[model samples]
Target: MGKVRGELRSHCPINFGIEIFGDRWTLLVLRDLLLQGKRRFGDFQASEEGISSNILAERLDRLTHYGLVTAERVAGDRRQIRYEPTEAGRALLPVLVEMAYWGARHDPRTAAPKSFALAYEADRAGLLRSVEAGTNPSEG
Candidate 1:
């Protein structure tokens, strides 16, 4: 049900990237991974947007196939798996942050966090850095 690149396709990185994440829900899932560190099914389902289980499963599998997310079995729980963002996935945080900021500005009543709005107003780079720090605490 999605577009596939043909052998005759030209090389446009943005187009290629869009093919991977141009869907309505994919980016939202990526946002959850990047912003909230959501790794399990329940965490994703608990999102205010309410994604269905089947769709979440499919999205997680797709993201894993695309190398954006890596799913590994939880230790001592063979039936459970945890999904985490790969480095490629973390690279999309800026885009999500920008989109959130734009949504907040266009709609005064947007329900995004006040901290995000304040950070957007002051310095998005700082916010991104903080997120990166949170994700990689060992770097310090």
Candidate 2:
């Protein structure tokens, strides 16, 4: 069961955010869902990070419980479920983008581009708008 806001150790917003994504795998699962557009269990397993099956299942369940993702059966396939981000999940785009910027800035070998940080810095709102409209800064 998810820890409700009232049950949290503190009412701090940052603490709430950390409670959702403090683990290593949760945010990566979200990155795949929101940024990489991966939906299947196999798809997430195939990620470069190579998360284990048990951990992925747990994270997906947690995300569903927390209203961050929705799992629906694939058309004509009851066994194959597709996962998608909910409004709450999509709202994490800024966090993802900021992390990308921070990584690109600090890491010499980061795959993230420096120009995107410049782009985001110049028009933070516009970039987020574009991403929400299915045009991501991560795309070529």
List the global CA lDDT of all models: 0.78, 0.84
Clashes of each: 0, 0
User: Residues 18-124, candidate 2, lDDT per residue (tens digit)?
Assistant: 88777889999998888778899999999999899988988898888889999999999899999999999999988987887888888989887766777788888
Residue 72 error for model 1, in Å? 0.2
lDDT of 1 by residue, 78-117 (tens): 7788999999888888888788788977897878666667
**Weakest 10 consecutive residues of candidate 1 by summed lDDT:** 1-10
The Cα RMSD in angstroms, rounded to one decimal, for candidate 1 relative to the true structure is 4.6
TM-score of every model?
Answer: 0.83, 0.87
Best by TM-score: 2
TM-score of candidate 1 against the unseen true structure: 0.83
Off by over 4 Å in 1: 1-10, 135-140
Model 2 accuracy (lDDT, Cα): 0.84
**Considering only N, C-alpha and C atoms within 3 Å, which residue pairs clash in candidate 2?**
none
Deviation of model 1 at 81, angstroms: 0.6
